[model samples]
Target: MWLNAILGPVSSPVIWVPASDTRKAWSSNARSSAATHREVFCSQGIFGGFMLGVKSISGMAFSFYDWEQLELIRRIEIQPRHVFWSESGNLVCLASDEAYYVLKYNPDVVARARETNASVTEDGIEDAFEVVGEVNETVKTGLWIGDCFIYTNSLNRISYYVGGEIVTISHLDHTMYILGYVAKENR
Candidate 1:
């Protein structure tokens, strides 16, 4: 199922929804409140491999849809600060404020979604897939190579996580980004 973004500056509302088989993008009114002040924030979302996601800065909202088909994968009120994917896009690492979660993507979820006519969610997604692992660490930066997720935490320590455990850890002199991995020399 596909619906357009509920986007607007809190005025003259317009809903972006699918027109027959074609989807359109338009602005919609933002739902407001005293605490929130306004609604529907947008940002430069994340894109990697075949996935793209619109995640707000305040961690209030997010939506990930298919770039080509415009299929809605999910929509929720909270989003991770960082999301990293394996080269195959089958494994994912979701870095939140307190912890990072590793999840396995079910290839059949999309097919099952077309059947349910609903976007998948945790409670009723029924895809038989879920978070595979979690570590109580806030990752500064990380990258995925095969089954292991290598990341640096606030302690400036580089740790390799695989199979639900931290397999290795080493202290770093300074902060740096993980550009890529070379298997032959093993860094």
Candidate 2:
């Protein structure tokens, strides 16, 4: 059956349906925690299309769905205190209580995942991700600035990542926190 081919033996419950496309549905598994917030983001790329659905709290996981085919491409386990996407949707920045991560979107992997019903394994996820940088103190929040990310750390300092190196920006007496930042005429 077409449904079986798309979703496999395990059926997914419909989470939301776009107003225009009733035939195409969005679905997810039962969330592990009620306290955690769930969010879905969709974006188009050169290979095809994809979406990121984040289940925050308890057992946190980032589930990537093939947007064009409407299939769960893969799932990656993450424990993030906070998560945010780049304005271009090309990067996902997340921070755990003790660390920070910037995950670049992989169109090649998305294409590979589209070829099979089986989800990508954890090893595959690791292979796709590159640890661009790390921090000793907890990362409070982060925002994308061009090809780099500016992260606010627990020490009231801002750390910047560009070209695989981290630059720390500190303040003497003032408590520095990122309320908001703008890039290239209101993006």
Candidate 3:
């Protein structure tokens, strides 16, 4: 039976269990003082392949897990106010209070995870992701507009990342917050 798990109340660690069998659940300690969000992704060709993301006071972190052994393989850090995986899941787009970043998934980490059985703490996996690009701007929220451009909601304007720089695409007089966005095509 497939299972569904609910995460948290913001200031605690995450607990997850099979809906039908609560006794067989798995839990991991919180990475920071306050926990904000979590996400799961696949690690391409690794044995366990599953990776988990937890956002907290320290930063956004991704932890690799070995399903069969139920061990944490490693943890990688990405400092962003918000983060989203691309449509293809090969890239991650991030929005910080003062900048935007794009990161490509690292296959080397998977290879290392497969070769080593030794576990790593959250602070150990420092070099897991490669930065593809960045744009200096205040990003309240952001999305990957195709594979090249990024659209972000700033304080009172909509900005975009193009040609390695941030360019304002639209402006507004009133303050606004962008929660989410959708990218239609590769451009």
TM per model?
A: 0.66, 0.58, 0.52
**Each prediction's number of clashing residue pairs:** 1, 0, 0
User: What ranges in model 3 sit over 4 Å off?
Assistant: 1-51, 56-79, 116-127, 176-187
Write down the lDDT of every candidate, Cα atoms only: 0.61, 0.52, 0.49
* C-alpha-based local distance difference test score of model 1: 0.61
Error of 2 at 64 (Å): 3.9
| Residue-wise C-alpha lDDT for candidate 2, range 74-176, written one tens digit per residue | 4566566566556666676667777777777766665655466234565243334445555555777677766777777777777777776888876436556
**Candidate 1, pairs of clashing residues:** 7-28
Name the candidate, 1 or 3, with the larger TM-score value: 1
TM-score of predicted model 1?
Answer: 0.66
Q: Per-residue lDDT of 79-121 in model 1, one digit per residue for the tens?
A: 6788787887778787878888887877687777768766556
- Residue 176, model 3, lDDT: 64
Q: Which stretches of candidate 1 lie over 4 Å from their true place?
A: 1-41, 116-129
lDDT of 3 by residue, 51-140 (tens): 334343344554444333344544555455566556555576666677767777765775575478333344543345667787676666
Q: What are the RMSD figures for all models against the true structure?
A: 9.2, 10.0, 8.6
TM-score of 3: 0.52
Sort every candidate by lDDT, greatest first. Answer: 1, 2, 3
